[model samples]
Target: MKLSIVDLSTVIPGETRHDALMKSIDVAQHIEKLGFHRIWVAEHHGAASIAGRAPEVLIPAIAANTSSIRVGSGSVLLNHYSVFKVAEVFCTLNELYPGRIDLGAGRATTGPITDFALQQDRSKQFRSDSDQQITELVAWLDHSFPDDHPFAKAPIHTIDSHPELYLLGSSAWSASAASQLGLPYVFAGFINQKGTRQIIDSYRSGFKPSAGRTGVKSPEVILSVHVVCADTEEEARRQIAPVHVMYDNLARGIIDAQMPAPDDAVKKLGGLPSLETYMKGSGKPPRFVAGTPDQVHEQLTQLSNDLSVDEIIIQDMMTNHDARLHSYDLLAGVFDFI
Candidate 1:
């Protein structure tokens, strides 16, 4: 029943990226005081709506501002970077924050143009070797590289401890990869909710602990889901209206649109349907959970139990900053996190 958070540093309408980032630090401090376990900022590129384009930079900022909450990347896109460098960065962060850092790694392409832009070698086709990257990254952090390996001589050891590592994903392949690597798996349920149970079950059934690695003795799963909680069901739906519109805009190839205010989004969408009906009619895996704290608690508890996950990481992108904080605060009270 443990709860954590994944913040995207979403830039609300009329807000600057700087505003969004400072708000992220405020969010980390707010949630830490609410007794949440961790807060991981997301990494996205070339998206005007998202300010967390580099989690490595944000993690330390958030960690320095908070006293106890674990801070890390919701994921650093491993496909775009070198495993050695990624390991070194997190190792350095661990040296600073000690046990309060986590390195959640995953593979994804931001977009064709941005992906190409991220490539160091324009002459070569982009490599899709995140599987190998994850393996090597773990070895680097664990200092488990073989004596003959080229990276064995790399001075990448941590002083006191290494950041806790988790594999972030929304697919069966990621689940299996995490299991093979013997790392904790975080399923992005907000992104793709279908086959969630099966994917996590597969991860657990196939898990093989990495020899000489110092974390995750057994398969551990954390489910990250979108949620909007309020004092009443009607209010929750109102708060969630902007998120619905944001998704709709993304579907329509409107990538640069900032999140609209809830009332404005509700007007744009011609009003929202009842939560139950909206979820059932979407014909897609439920994209988000929205309701009163009691209702959200029930749905989240059911999702956690059904998937047999150890923790739940809540992800929400609401336009109203106070409302967003309020949503989490209400959930904390409901879950008795404080």
Candidate 2:
């Protein structure tokens, strides 16, 4: 299976945004040497724990530092930007890095206030026309706007190639939109884990290639999940403790300034067993897959086979930077990426 990564540029306790970002670049270089396929940074606005607020800015920084690994937005949150401008930014990156940029688009809101903050025109009522946005974005990237359309004359300023596009979604609605647009679909299993099989199958069955589109002639799917791998299963559980606390706090309307260290997180949650029980009773599939290298490999392989996908993109929320790096290294080794 092809292994990829989705980094949140997480800010652990006692770390600044700059520190988190530098660590992200370090991770990109490390994974590149380990033969990982791609590393897409996530965009989360006004979140103290996540430093990757602008993927367009981060993409170039990562690309400049890494020689081979693909670098792009995990999802640019298309709701906040113009289709033409988004196209220009990513296409320019593609020109700069060629064959190593991906434009993963999504329609998630940063938050109501942040959404309003991101809007260019606050006088207008907020509305999301993600379907139309995706369609227009694809047209702009492909330069396939109709002759009579106003944007037909607008230039994207890139010649020869455009960044690869992937529609990021966690629901059947997203699956349908991606299918209609003939773009690759990245299922956000870490965000929403329900009905995985049905959503992907629907995407494939309904897929219709857009005429003259530059990439993805057929249905393509990549499953993105949260994982924390360690040399032992117990250690993996310990590493993932911070993520559990973070989720618990979010559920209670608490926004942490930074992800807590593992010991502090475990203390906050009472214990790992309590966290596991709470997660199981939350009426969702376990959001994280934390285990030994062999265990993680087995679970991921089964998940891939069950979903009928060849690629899996992992997202980890560990507080220890060294342990986080080691987790990825172990994962790569298990997948024979090293």
Candidate 3:
């Protein structure tokens, strides 16, 4: 029943990346004041619409700006960098903020093309072993390794504490891995909605205890999805039109740095003859929820109950900064978060 925010640091057209980042901090502070649980920034590369390409660099500024509500990466693409380096960066953050930081890692890439670009820029291997990365990351955080291991000889500087770690994913494989490792798991319902009930069930049923996850002997699950809340259900649906258009554009290889105005997006939707039909179809369930505050609250509550999750993290892709802020405020009031 806990609520949290996930900011994509999405760039609005006509605004600089600085503006988006500043808005991110503004949103973080706003939610913290409203008594939300946490605000996690996302990682997106080669996308003009997303400004949070480097969460490691942004986390410090955000943590400094907000007094409470935990601030961390929605995920650092673990496949892109070294485990030791990733551990070092977050370890430093934890040293500064102590218990106020989180380390959510995932295996997402910007795009197939961007994958090639990142590998070339870093001059490192592109393929990843998420299990190995997680094992090493936990080992580094604990400053413990098997007696015969190389890291045992040259220990990384130990900290009095470690950042709270969570595995982020939209797949069953990820659920199983997080469960087996006894780490908290976040299911990206917005990214992929198919078979989520089964996924959560699998995660809980498969959970195993580990020294690294003593804080969570049982499975901890959070369901993250896109949400657009407004004063009226109809208005909310209209406001989310641009977001739907944005998804369609991305699937078609079109990327816009800023969210197109909802009115404009409605007009553009006419060109896609099958778009309306797809929206009208009842065969596939939606990956997002758009409604008035009360309506959204009901749906979100039902979603959490259905999946038996501990928390629901809201992800909003709306363009209007004030409206985006208001959405969280409305949800807070509905959920009695304060």
- Among all windows of ten consecutive residues in candidate 1, which has the lowest summed lDDT? 276-285
- Model 3 alpha-carbon drift over 4 Å, by segment: 120-125, 158-160, 213-215, 271-285
Tell me the lDDT of candidate 2.
0.84
| Candidate 2 weakest lDDT stretch, 10 residues | 274-283
lDDT of 2 by residue, 108-151 (tens): 87778998999999999887658888888877767787999987
Cα deviation at 72, candidate 3, in Å, is 1.0
lDDT of 1 by residue, 1-338 (tens): 88999999989889899999999999999999999999999999988788999999999999999989999998999989978788878888988998899999999988889989999988988775588888888887778778999878866435336788899998888999999888899998878866777788899999998775545778888988888899988788888898888778889999887788888988998986458422432223357888998888877777666567769898988889999999989999999987
TM-score of 3: 0.91
Instruction: Score each candidate by Cα lDDT.
Output: 0.85, 0.84, 0.79
lDDT of 3 at 54: 88
Whichever of 2 and 3 has more TM-score, that candidate is: 2
Which residue pairs overlap in candidate 1's backbone?
A: none
